[model samples]
Target: MEQDLWSVEFTSLADAIRSGRVTSTELTELMLARIAAFDGRLHSYIAVAPDLARAAARAADAEIAQGHWRGPLHGVPMAVKDVFYTKDIRTGFGSSIYDDFEAPYESTATARLRAAGAVMLGKLTATEGVYAGYHPSITEPVNPFGDEHWTGNSSSGSGVAVTSGLAYGTLGTDTGGSIRLPSACCGLTGIKPTWGRVSRHGVFPLAESLDHVGPMARSARDAAALLGAIAGADPDDPTAASVPVHDYLAQIDAGIAGVTIGIDRDFIAAKATPEVAASIETVIPILEQLGARFVPATFPETREILYGWHTECSVEAALAHRATFPGRRAEYGERLSALLDHGAQVTAFELAEAQRARRAFNGAVAAMFAPIDLFLVPALPVAGPTLAHMATLGPDPDGILAVGPFNAPFDICGYPTITVPCGANGAGIPIAFQLAGKPFSEALLCRAAHAWQGVTDWHRRRPEL
Candidate 1:
């Protein structure tokens, strides 16, 4: 095995493993070794299932030797956010209260990946209850690009593991900006698939209605492959869309020629920081050069919906935790506790107003997408903020609340959005832009992102872990 094999993308790794040039055991062991060597500092995983991974790898190798090639994910090693239940594994939903809890069955998404022959590297870390901050007892994953920089939560572990070569790809759940924020912060390609496009059954939730299960990887094609393996309607999750799952890998090469990309320049300029604005401006021409046509578009008024996001998410989160919270509230972290406390105080009238606003926001977003196949926007207003700055977000909520303008609306509307590295800041931290489309339009978004990645080396760059 090549010494740098652990650093390869999911697509390449899959191809190699399927071709028998790289055995699953070899790849799995290599990843385990890397985690042992580096996770002390990175803390990208909540638990390391070495025995389970090795057993699965051996089984995959045996099956492949017998001519049973599963698919693109065969013999590939990957991990998922701790929120996704892994049968019999300590599925800590980033909360100490459930640190010893193990599910009898796995999440539909992770189960699908396992059936597709992907090895379980383990459960990656996430924020407490899959909300904004880590549990006081849980160590946060350090940004591989810069130690002091934030690795966007609550999928911080997903971003760090992939970018730092600990995992080729990982499943990330996004309610707000969990997936996209980490992808932007860590310079990776992440897809927050249309809500219901992927099943959430058996997965722990922070905000049930808003939560989305998706993949994060080093490239668009790799993300597409992961998405394909895990997507499709599941009986266990009635909410999982009954629509057909595209062969995203096959659709990824369709290219973006003649595709209409909507750009709300005034919206971006007003919402994004100078660094982010400049980086997004730079990505526009690159996409144009690839034959994507850009057109002027204006975003709908967002303040009402954005403000209401807190109320809705908090209420839902409070509900999701109703079984154990308050009764076991002592075990909960301060941030998550505060969220629940806030939710408990919300009046029935307030919740009704928030839901009504969400409906309006969803309709407005749908209308906005009618003229364009995709809407291009900044993934984050500020790129890779320091850990110290992120700490302040707790006290001065607006700093973090401002992020909803770029990311949360899509979650609110259940639109398919992909975030890809476009440029980097002076300190070499990455800046990314999101391409959001109508529901279940992941194929097109992947095509556009994959095309840009082919012409640009941003996705190929890795941190020196």
Candidate 2:
């Protein structure tokens, strides 16, 4: 197989290397070539570590050449979200405030990726502090999927990198739909594993309790591969879950048989656009043909759950930037500055009410999961809305909520969610269907996503842009 690295999946690349079809150095060089060739137009890469990546890729090549194989992620050419520190890399969280802040050590997630033998393509751009959907203040990485469309933030660059073929996949931190929102916009698959499933040690946090570090990739299978590489308990991150490592890749292709999938119709019905609605409507037969049982349900507290999410994000972000906010409140985007201000003014009583809403909402969602392996909903309310449009909330009153209302509760409740491409809109940008499962039920979630992908062409389609 003489495919360029842009179109290569890491698993396929590794297997080929194992069988002498290709070498890791060749694969890595292909990626480096692609990045060097394409990233100038996309601006997807904030930095390209040619020296470091070649070294790691060469080592992977040497290991395989010597009959030593590291792991599933071994030899994969991947990019890091700037929020996660790579020891020698100049780590900036897309904010000038952190422009020169270099860590003497590495993030646990970064360490894990290194241990798995993954090669870094350097840090990708992000919105300032991973805040708004757009960050022109720093990098101008275009969507490169649909006319420079804004993949929702804060982990904006991760989506751009993956979709633009800058890397096989990239890491992203999610507090409120950062991962899935961009995935939907950029036509990629992203997972916000139940909050603690992955370590947050090296990542800059938006909300400590709500932030999750996960992958955005070309397919659910790829996302699963990357997830397995980095997820586990990290002693440095006290909040990391102490659970059995899931064989995320093995869980795919269970055929969707005997799986009870729930269609959250009310939620789907309310936010879906004509195109998004049609895309999701088309999935019914796909699931039915797979012998999947479908249940229709709704969470009573969906609205309240969202309000609480914003409250939590703002409050936590404000707390983290206590010093910065006071010095130059102008440094933040309008949306974020206003939010942090409101969060600062939030009364204890209001916080308590939001907490109560969160509790009630989590209970409702958990109860909904009682009989279903996954809940399926459109990943975005509308597919790939223009970057300029999403930045200002445009004419859409519902805003990012349209694409990710189901996501925040997943964050608050710490549930597993994977957004896979379902279909594309008229403009040909891909739309997605999200599979959300009970907490730590990623095993079941991956199985169902794998099944869904079996008969669908969504995963096969790529943006022409």
Model 1 Cα lDDT, one tens digit per residue, 1-465: 455697778687666777788899998888999999999999999988999999999999999989899988888889999988878568989988886686988788888999999989898999999888789889989998999898898899999999988888999999889999999999999999999999999988888899999999999999999999889999999999999999899878888999999999899889888888888889889999999999998888888887788888888988999999889988888888888998998999999999999999888888888999999999988876787776665531355577657889888899999999998888889889999998899999999999999999998878987
What is the per-residue lDDT of model 2 for residues 1-465, given as tens digits with 9 covering 90 to 100? 334556645665667767656766776787788778777777777778889888988888888778888866787888888889888777878876676787878998888888888888799888777765444477567766666466667667788778766688889988878898878777787898997999998788778878999988887788888888889898988999999888888767656787787886766667667777778888888888888888887655577778777777778888988888857876666656766787798888888888888888778778888877778877777766776555666322145454566667688888889888887766666778888877787777777777777777677665553
List candidate 2 segments past 4 Å from native.
1-4, 133-136, 391-403
The TM-scores of all predictions, comma-separated, are 0.98, 0.94
* Candidate that would win on TM-score: 1
TM-score of 1: 0.98
Flag regions of model 1 displaced more than 4 Å.
1-3, 394-399
Worst 10 residues of 2 by lDDT: 394-403
Task: Provide the lDDT at 174 for model 1.
Answer: 92
